[model samples]
Target: MTVPKGKLIIIGGAVDMGSNISAQENILQPNYIKFFEQGILKRIITESAHHEASKVEVITTASQIPELVSTEYISAFNHLGVNHINILDIRTREDASNPEYLQRIRKADVVMFSGGDQLRLSAIFGGTEFLQILKQRYQKDNFVIAGTSAGAAAAATHMIYRGSSNEALIKGHVQITAGLGFIDSVFVDTHFVQRGRIGRLLYAVASNPGILGIGLGEDAGLLITEGSMMEAIGSGLIILVDGRNMVETNIYDVEIGAPVSIENLKVHVMSIYDKYDLLQHKLLIKKVVKVENGVFIKADK
Candidate 1:
């Protein structure tokens, strides 16, 4: 089967929720305190075709405060001058099968999932026709799927539900479950740095070394194209934990709650504009300039 080249915008939360200012007033304001100042929203807008006419649907199923989440996105999209935005208030599995909701999913150019509990999303949408349609649309059309925090974490087949940053290296500290299965070979963890999730991500990699661990920092995100090529964007770092070269791991043998041991796991830290090739399991280095002793210098030969 030929796979479609759909786009995914995965964000680590804390994107402008700190705003005390009004959304309408902050439309063009570039102040640091304002929302959408982090360029992630703009990047999302640019990814959609015919920005002015594209229909964007916001799915608030993961959020406990669905109304608040929906309103924020609505305001942000409006500020970005995008018309035809809809909010899918799908709170239950029954709602997931609603024809009206299914039709909305059919016509949307971009479907965004808000941050909340990832479990809520899986429980509500699992095995539903709505989810099947969404997956079909993603696999066969020029569609875009965006998610933040929990939303981002649930985009993969194996999801991190409960994991402690403090005790992440312990054998039983990290808990993972099945997700929406959008991407199967990658395990995603959001609010990476802010929540001190590196240890947890490493533990996940140690246990399931076959997959890649993506630790997304707050206000940071990656724009994935053609399923496997990811370009980093936003203000923070994208930490990739690659275990393809791992030499040893004690996770399987260690008793539950015991500290786990791992060796030779590869780690990659990327900044804005960095790109990664998942198909080849390689980082694509870019030719750029460097600063040497207060002098700008070219790094590319």
Candidate 2:
């Protein structure tokens, strides 16, 4: 398999873009401020080859409130000192084929997908020239593809389109479909911890042990390089469910709507600074120590 030259930043839901809450609420909740002000968005800019000069294209195709999301993202990026940003409000199949949008995509350094419905992303850009250009750029250039919520979920080869957290363990409860195919053999689910989505992600992996399941929590994300090396970022948790060592599972035999059973399914929880290798299926953690100056520093494990 050929390794990709670009980067993929997959973020869980609830990334505050300075539009979700009022100034008073933001002042009261400083944590939300950190997420946008000095967190994931900042990292996205830093990872770009040209940093602030990178031409960013915000694809609001997945969002229902495209205008609101576009305005919010523009504010967020401007706050981070990134001025070259454009919002691509591609809402229809024909819009996905627009020559102007295609030209803009060719020159863009970073492409960001906002949170909304994953199916819209797949149905709209699945086989279009637009997706083809994005894939080519990802494979050959130092491009960056960042997505939050539904955008994150649709970055993988297989996507979980429908699944109820309460009944996720039941056979056939979780629905799977082809996604944008930016990454393979991986299934990503957003709003993980906040919505209790582990059951659905587990079921996805249990059904297909070859596929790795990643559950991303709100305000959390992973910065992936070479399409394999993943560095955990943001302030929330990230769950990895590995079913490769599974000894037994009754998902196939169990009747629909019945609870399925699985044994020896391995799970790993990660936080900021943690690293996970998608190809090797290994986890590496970073240890930190606080100094006398009341500052934290990395320490050798």
The global C-alpha lDDT for each of the candidates, from Candidate 1 onward, is: 0.80, 0.87
lDDT of 2 by residue, 124-221 (tens): 99999999999999999999999998899999989999999999999887999999999998899998997899999999999999998999988789
Q: Each prediction's Cα RMSD?
A: 4.8, 3.3
**lDDT measured at residue 41 in model 1 versus the true structure, 0 to 100:** 76
lDDT of 1 by residue, 1-301 (tens): 3455678899887665334421221223322423253468778878886665789998888877777667778777787788788999988898889999999889898998888889998889888898898888888888889888888999999999997799999888799998988877899998798779999899988888999999998778899988888988776778999998999988889899899889999999876677898888878655448744432233322
Worst 10 residues of 1 by lDDT: 21-30
Best by TM-score: 2
Off by over 4 Å in 2: 18-33, 291-297
TM-score of 2: 0.93
Candidate 1 stretches greater than 4 Å from native:
17-38, 287-301
